[model samples]
Target chain A: MTVTAPPARGAITAGEPIRLTSVNKTYTTATGPLPVLQDIDLHIETGEFVSLVGPSGCGKSTLLKIIAGLIPFDNGTVHVGEQAPKEGRRDVGFMLQQSVLMPWLSVRENVTLPFAIAREKGSHIAPRVEELLELVGLSHSADMNSWELSGGMQQRVALARTLALDPRVLLMDEPFAALDEFKREHLGLEVTKMHEDMGKTSILVTHSIPEAVMMSDRIIALGARPGRVVGDIRVDLPRPRSAAMIATPEFQDISRQVREALAGEDGSIS
Target chain B: MTTIQTPPQPAVVRAETVPHTKPKDPLLSRTWVKVGLPLLVLALGVGAWEVASQTGLVNPITVPPASDTFAAMIDLSTKDYFWHAAWITLQETLLGFLIGSTLGLVLGALTGTFAVFRTALWPFIVAIQNTPRVALAPVFLTWFGFGMTSKVVMAAVICFFPVVINTVAGLSSVDANARMLFRTYGATTSQTFFRLTLPTAAPVTFAGIKTALTLALLGAIVGEFVGASEGLGVLVNEFNFQLEVAMGFAVVVYLAVIGLILYALIEWLERRLITWSN
Candidate 1:
């Protein structure tokens, strides 16, 4: 079946997009040498929202790590934008499963982390941090320490920190997986809105099928045990997605389609 | 003659009325378990000691009754002996605690950050920690002489190990993801250390300080016992020489008070500095 592509921002430029070609990674464990990813070929277009959905231990997180320039693949070349993945660019932001906010820092300080490294002579950072905090609806909590926040509020701070560099790509690894359903849905909507406003390339690693359907322009599925890409479904849903979308037949149908694609595929796209 | 019927409350109100609730106990109420019980046990022990002495089960000459010990404390307090002795020991303990904690914090951070430094210095620190500090009291006395210097050195030596051990543990216990997050931002090495590692380790380092405070007092007392003309330990020694058991016990009580005060001070400082950690 030829699936219709999602709404396009046009073809990504070769000079400024992340590309992974035939990447493979193996880790030495006590059991034996464990192979995690095999011949992984993937590309994330600029300003695109992509989601990776898979079973546990499918190396989905490992793929995101590789793209983040955190881990080296044993074989094949990985490229971030046009450059070889040495350190990638400080312009890329990472959000992990846990909202790793520094407890010692207040929300405002946490938001201004990247700029505090070596701010330019005349560049103003406080306004930018305040803007981001306001965007995340955490302006009232800017002076509060991270530990004082509820888990959802802390993740919001994490999101603010991720935007500190005004990054072109946001790599999120199950960022909201630990939260309860109500919190997850609420934050997910905010994240979707941010994606639209920021127009940054985003890759969300998640196990929730509804989350993938609700958020992404494209949902990439991988099979477990030496992970390989098995299905790529384009989500044709409209912008400004909401919690109410879950109840609509259109959303349910897409979720069902993705669910089948995940269940039927056995590590072979064909 | 007439039956009266009352309107029933709403389902929500009925649910609220029988809501499953847990009674919240105040900190003061909980203190009975933590503080009151221990105080009661101590009082019982003191009473038993007094009764044993009164009944002549244990000779009053060898182990003075509680009344005599209290009398000795009153006599010492009135004469300013307790104040003078405590002030001297407090100075030595404070110096040792400061020096020992500074060195430990610096060394622990360096060792935790650099693999080679950790490997090179770990063995020496271990060796020093293994050696009984009491056995080295005479050595410090000979080197620094029977004065404040020897007592301070002994206190520093005694306080050093806990600070090092706890600081290292605290530094190492920083969350792996937090470090990775810093790296992603291209944070400099020093930035990572200050922003993530130090704050993460503050609680553990504070724990080390509390331990060191008590140890420093003990070390100062032992050093004074080996050779000194002043301080509570010296007073205890002088009383022992004169066969004044009651006076020795009184000095012992004063030393305990000093140690308690020092530990409490460090604990308060720790709470103030790391309020965000919890």
Candidate 2:
């Protein structure tokens, strides 16, 4: 098994984007005590797309939640930039497994929700919302209710909503996991394109080995049950990857390596 | 920050993309299904009643069908008996509704806000709600006496529980993610209450109010049933005692009309007030 250096707890090195230090999480259950995550550490740099992958029951989602500040770890700390804030909310944006759009609001209103909440007296957000809608290719459905749109369209609205805050860090938990293969591939390309254009640091939690390989700058593979880092494969693949990249030998090689790492841990960890 | 603008083409795209299906016009659908059909049925029923009375198909003294009932209604209107009965009954119903709804809203909002209030008050509320107001009408009459005040109080009490139940349900119906999302923005508790909790609760509370309007009206009528000298309930009772079935039936029609009007009015208000909810 290959192991990467545990990310330093508090320090954000000159170029290091995010650091998780000895982060552990556990949940209390009626049956018994359950440990979701053990002391795990990893660092991701700016403009890096890191995918966390493991079997079901692994704490990939839990770790992403901790980073998003949606949940607190039982022990250890996480630093979004140099460190976590002392008070109030963090500016880190998040996308969940489900669309979670406000059913009552139109797609445009859903997209601009964070802005509406944070609007100044003279603040202008219409243009920003429009730009985001266009970017997500949802410009045409802005006026429609979220329920009126297809599931894929609704998720796109959710993505646009995440961008509404324009945060420095994006934490996504299986954002495209619900879509079909074609939609997933299409969205993966769009996400890659968006990441390249915006240069935002992102942590994606996914189950698909091919998806992790296709999208990430680095893939963090965790062992199942009491999820902990087992392998981190840096894809030195060149930029501007497209759907065509999945057909190439280089893409196949990275996919093979990540799969082997996943299978190896899958067999031994449980 | 750039000015917020909605993409305009979607409406057109949606218009083009929306599959042609049955009943595209919602207004037309509502008119045909909600209004026109009901009106047609009512008209036919009234016409049948008039025909039956004129043809002597039924005993005029017993059923007293349409013409005599219409004449009784006309007489009542001319003598201002209709207005007197309507005014008194309407007063009791409206006052009771307002008082009961206000108390319900306050209690509901408070209980929903505080766990202690919920624990203490919820059981009593449920008990009161399940207890039929009809059974308590005479009890209220005894306590407050057979007066307008008693009727008003009874009406209010009858209307109160549903409002409280609905308001609490609405307040607690807030989405968990939405709550967390607001918290993420550092929203104060009061901010969350007003911005998210209150608005979300509005539609549900309005539903309760819409339902309560009719119950309040029924309570006022029922209170009149127990004891009253000058309201519609009294008028109906007087006609029943004299066996003036047509006059009694006329008063019954008026009561139904009043109840229907209030029900429709509340429904309209609910829609108008919570238009943004949809």
Candidate 3:
């Protein structure tokens, strides 16, 4: 696995390392205090693609949310680049399982939403929107309503929207979970290509082992029941990974390693 | 983020269910079934009324023949008095709806957005809404007088609650994921309300406005009925006293036509404003 040296402090850029130290999260439920994550220590280098794979009760999504600054952790220090994780940081883009596009807005308008919210003004915005749509292959459907697009196309539009502000750290939570095998694989390859082209630090949470192996430079296997880091296996596969790589011995070996790491805890890899 | 702790089961590919084909109704397929049927029912109703009146099956004093009613309508049309009354009622309904809906929208928006306003104002709004609006017509007449002002006030009062209720509901119905997305974008409270909440609430708010419009018409008529020198309701009362039952029926028909026109106008506006909803 290639690990880029950390940039100088206070130097924010397109790609930044994410560091989490002893992250602990507990949900105060009706029954009692339910611990979700315990002592999670992760260090993702600049421009590295990481995937968090685990069973059903694993706090993979929760951990991702913590890094995204969507929720607070009881005990931890999370750093996105040199700064503490903060909500609505222009440099951090968080994408969820569902597309969650505004039904009323057109595809172009949806992509331009972040700029509108920030009240950004410039001649550059229109061109940037067009470029993003082009990147997502939704240029033809720019004027169409979000609801008119298919599930896969909508997800692509969402990907475009997430990259609207050129966020450095892209956190995805089961983005392709709802898609079919064909679309899922197709989108996985597209995202890998985008990651390579843009060189943005990305972390994805998924249930599928092959998805994790196909996309990530390193697969962080997590265990359930007070989720903690179980295994951190580095993928020695070639860069610019394609669908054909999934059938290779190296890809299968890395997938087996991830599955074994997950199997050690609950033997319940869904 | 509800947790599912079920044991891992083998993935089951669901067989696509065959689409159920609905049997065609032969009679319903005809254009006559859609249009001619209602007209036929109406004709039969009018014919039955005429027969009953001619055969003295009911009191002619109260139940006038359809022909007599049409004659009364023609007679009323010739006079400027009926038109003036209708004009006054329309003005009252329009003004009242505008005022009431605006107030309701503002208050509802406040209540939905801010917890303090919701807690402080919600109970009072409910209490006032619960009080029958028609019952307040006499009080409105006493306060605003027997002119168009009183009827306008009555209509506004009647129109207020539905808008408030629907507005609150519409504002609350915003998707959770959308709210999270807005938060992630660092949107200000007002920005979120305007861009996300307002657009989300529009379809529901329009529904309330449509309902409130019809109620506004009813409110105006009721106010005129209680105490007014002009309006279609006043004409109906006068015709009753003079035993011109057919004339009262004619005035009712005019009110129905006005109601239909108002409803159609609202529907057209709804389609224009909420184009993406469809």
| Best-fitting candidate, scored by DockQ | 3
- DockQ for all models: 0.36, 0.22, 0.57
**Deviation in Å, model 3, residue A135 alpha carbon:** 1.8
Error of 3 at A198 (Å): 1.9
In candidate 1, stretches whose alpha carbon ends up further than 4 angstroms from where it belongs are: A1-16, A28-33, A86-88, A118-123, A264-270, B1-58, B65-67, B78-84, B120-131, B139-145
Candidate 2 local accuracy as lDDT?
Answer: 0.78
Better lDDT candidate (1, 2): 1
Over the stretch A116-209, how does candidate 3's per-residue lDDT look in tens digits?
Answer: 9979777878988998999999999999999999999999999999988888899999999989999998999999998988889999999889
Q: Compute the lDDT of residue A240 as modeled in candidate 3.
A: 79
A184-215 per-residue lDDT for model 1 (tens digits)? 98899889988887678889999898999899
Two-way DockQ contest, 1 vs 2, winner: 1
Q: Model 3 segments beyond 4 Å from truth?
A: A1-14, A264-268, B1-37, B47-61, B127-131
Candidate 3 or 1, higher TM-score: 3
Compared with the true structure, all predictions reach lDDT values of 0.80, 0.78, 0.87
Q: Is candidate 1 or candidate 3 better by lDDT?
A: 3
Put the candidates in TM-score order, highest first.
3, 2, 1
**lDDT for position B141 in model 3:** 90
Best-fitting candidate, scored by lDDT = 3
